[model samples]
Target: MGSTEEERPEGLLGWCLVANVARETLHGDSGLDLQHGTKHFSADALLWIPPIPWDPGHWRWPAVGRHRGNSRRYINMVVRAEDLENFRVKGVYSEALVRSLNGHRHDPAAPRTLQNPWSREQAQSWADRWNQPREPVRIDGRSHPLLSVPNPPPAELRVNGETLHLAHYGTRGAHYSRNPPPTEQP
Candidate 1:
């Protein structure tokens, strides 16, 4: 049996909400199992959780959260290497801003932040709301869900004879030379 590119199961790419304290302790399996595993879904376009450190000025940086005391932070579930192929450039989100969300009590009806070992509902809501196109918001002065479903950053890799170059989002890049090191003249 064989499968075509389109036929292959669209790789699952989504985030799971985990507690800040348990951020480093939790594994993909445990993260997936949170919220009764209801938030888990077949992600088609993008998988990275935003507020990446590459841009500290962005709102999501440091992880956004509702205002409340003794509140536990939320960290996105880590995506596995095998799943990298599913992402644009194997784009992996940062775990830096562990507790980086705007802790504002703007709306009294807004959902409250959860503490360590978050409850199933907290996990579910976070996962469900992530990158929801319908829910409009601005980040880094840009409208989010950027059309309801954010598209993966554009990535390209090319080789020119003796050099290899790879770039993504024009924000970062990598280059390498194929030539061997010069020999020492003794």
Candidate 2:
């Protein structure tokens, strides 16, 4: 018999749902967050979505600690090569975030953040501005460069009621096995 849909491999890029539902005794509410829904990833890199809190003053805990869980639930995907390329081409560029994706430790001075790539319309506007050069203008006692549109940096994809962030890679090590405790001989 041919392989089923579950037997296929995911492409080098694109989004996928990652759910982790490990036992509660070993973890806390943190495991529940990962159990909720979809996520995106490249071949070896995972997208780290920032957590939103109901109260801006209080820091959210679940999203930050999902990694402590030991179990996960996800479906395998079969993706085309071209689709992967599309993601890479349109993907946002962040030097710090990219470093983390490549499995490097985060730099203290450079907190990782996602900057979305320019959209077609936005890019066109930028081009138009550059094409027609003009003198700088003074704003709030500071000279602003001509054609500067201070739009927030681009970020890709907005999941309903959820925030997405870039993943940070840190020191990696192998899991070590411990020796069994001494037992009485029969």
Candidate 3:
């Protein structure tokens, strides 16, 4: 950000966690390490709080995933060491696991998955672009009311248990079509 100012934020720090969780990257026990619920890990001196993706109005599981009308529910969250919460167990946590996810703070829109690996960099930029106090994303022109939920990146990242599986991913022209065979992520 110091040198690349105009195209990005004024003080953009490139070292940010990227907050990435693509199914391909989270495959195996790796996904298990990054469970759906919030976690209090140290990405360095900065505390990391990976909040579970959820809803505000009815306090239900918010939809998430790549394709249209499809959604994946997360099950964990993390907070900074100084954050006001603690992990009491280690299993499939229920709704009660997250008492104050600030549901009053999340109105997430399942943004479309980034269509390219280069866009992975674009999606990473949102770490700084959307981190500030702002409104959540909008789908079909409607925004979630909470306005604090960190919307999913404009890319689909699926994780089975603790593993990221590239079931089938690629670009448009050469993508895996339902008719024949499933391909791979590029």
TM-score of each: 0.19, 0.17, 0.17
lDDT of 3 by residue, 29-103 (tens): 412343332322222212112333323332222211122122233323332221122211121122321222223
Residue 15 alpha-carbon offset, candidate 2, angstroms: 18
> Mind giving the per-residue lDDT tens digits that candidate 1 earns over 1-186?
555544433431223343221112112542343221112222231333332324434222232322223124443333332222211212113232222321232233533321222333554565455423222222223333322212332122232332322222211112222333356999
Question: What ranking of all candidate models by lDDT puts the best one first?
Answer: 1, 3, 2
Query: What lDDT, from 0 to 1, does candidate 3 have?
Result: 0.27
| TM-score, cand. 3 vs. native | 0.17
Evaluated at residue 1, the lDDT of candidate 2 is: 71
- lDDT for 152 in candidate 2 is 28
Instruction: Between candidates 1 and 3, name the one with more favorable lDDT.
Output: 1
lDDT of 1 at 2: 58
lDDT per residue (tens digit) for residues 1-186 in model 2: 757334433322211111222121111352233222223222322322221222332211112111223223222222211111111112324443333332334355544432222333444443354334222222223332321222221122123543333121111111111222246999
| Model 3 steric clash total | 28
Best candidate, TM-score: 1
lDDT of each: 0.29, 0.27, 0.27
Model 3 per-residue lDDT at 75: 28
